[model samples]
Target: MIRRTRHVPQIASSEITPETVWLNRRNLIKAAAAGTMATTLPTLASQTPDLKPLSYVPGECDGCAAEEALTPLEDATSYNNFYEFGTDKSDPAEYAHNMTIDPWSVEVSGLVNKPGKLNLEDVLSGFDLEERVYRFRCVEAWSMVVPWIGFPLADLLQRFEPTADARYVAFKTLYRPKEMRGTRSFTSVIDWPYREGLRLDEAMHPLTLMAVGLYGKTLPNQNGAPLRLVVPWKYGFKSIKSIVSIELTDQQPKTSWQELAAQEYGFFSNVNPEVDHPRWSQRYERRLPSSLFKPNRVPTQLFNGYADQVASLYTGMDLKKYY
Candidate 1:
């Protein structure tokens, strides 16, 4: 059952950069240095021939606050934690272009009535996309307010008809060493094909989205082109990127981060400021596009400020214990 609570907060118009400003900024940067700007500009969607402008109803989904400023497209795309490309924040924007995403297909299998490979086109054709302004909080104590374009995960999972035995839903990222350089990097400690999972109910939550685009355009390769998951209430890592496989399993799937360091990353990594990371405090976050002169720091919220909508999901569990 999809929740009909439509009173979620909306982002203030003053905080959003006008579309014209974004275009003009890109143009100015390009005119200054064609070669340098080619890789730095936020207009990455324009470079991909197959990537098209997405049609989505604006501000339909929820979990944004009126005071939050939407992060600039450049900062959101350039600074990322896509370890499949490299461990560095700038690595994704520099190396993700090498990944091939046009003929993408996701394999749906395990404990489902219908199991098969569905092409990206087929998936998009089935649903009406909506633009959702969501607060993306990272475990590293940084955050961003992003306008994501996608449909609810519940709608897609329902089509597969998950069997009663399915207790959790597991997702996997694409792994091609030839293209993803980080897979072969000696400094990497993660097991290949980064995996993430959610309990069945959490996966079915109306707030859980399967995103294909952002900022009214198809996703840039650096930002998980073609497909990704967006669970706004949880830390950003819960939203897996470049997803290629989805499985309905009876047990909690071992996630990549948990495998790398179970003490630091838990399966139910809900945003709880009280439960600090082993090495850093989760109580505060530096919103992106921040500088040393102006830190733009803000107090972190429980469930990333979606507690009113998601607290029920963790009513009986101990967050600190699970986290």
Candidate 2:
């Protein structure tokens, strides 16, 4: 029998239906905020210069047909995965304050007809913010809900006008190990200057976001300060942080995890409870800041519990092998 806890929702096992899997707007918002709170805020509190409580209101599920979708960011900036500037999560939060990001430029090239380094301000000024509540599953087996504010990747790509030749979108993270101490670690398993990608379709999905911030504050450096990708249904690794470049290409881009272990990290790293990690079960995850005396492990869900909105995207694909 499939065992479930109090927080886990019940589902019909007869078929994989999108209508049944999608979260309502209100619940989506709750999950997003909760997830962010669980993953980011603890670290943020330690590194945040002001130690101020950022502006945030309760979020609601947006017609997702699910109850209580929102989740808070546990530690806004103190996330433990700041590989963009360095490997340790706290390293970026501390070292990134010195980064002069105002004169930033992003190179958009490869299969695109128009290729050049674009000003960061110009790129940022062009979009509107949309609050998307999504389930976040970290590779280490923790999870949260995050109400991300950003526009769809497709909306941004439309402006660039990718040629039909474009089949992939590759993102490059900022590499400054001298300033970021985590990169200097000799025993680090992850490569410096992390990279990530998506099939053209995944990149263009309405749920995918090119995020600049969370919890209504400027994105803290440790949390992919300038720009990051948010692929809700996939594992957090798919969401590359602190991106400095975005290249549209005919061939698939090399990603950090896939490079480390192709068999373990697929190009599409969607979260599926049915498939267990090599050393752990993906069936459940621990929410950060969990009560010391109580149960902390939260159940994992299909499509990270956003299947209702994105299940169709992977209709006939074999998730077990790809995962």
Residue lDDT tens for model 2, 92-143: 5555655445567777877777777767676567677655566678877886
Candidate RMSDs in Å, in order, are 14.1, 15.9
lDDT of 2: 0.70
* Per-model lDDT: 0.86, 0.70
Native RMSD of candidate 1 (Å): 14.1
lDDT of 1 at 53: 84
**Model 1: lDDT of residue 222:** 79
- Which 10-residue window of candidate 2 scores lowest in summed lDDT? 44-53
The reply for model 1, stretches above 4 Å from the true place, is: 1-50, 59-67
TM-score of each: 0.86, 0.77
Q: Which has the greatest TM-score?
A: 1
Off by over 4 Å in 2: 1-74, 84-95
Angstrom error at residue 63, model 1:
2.8
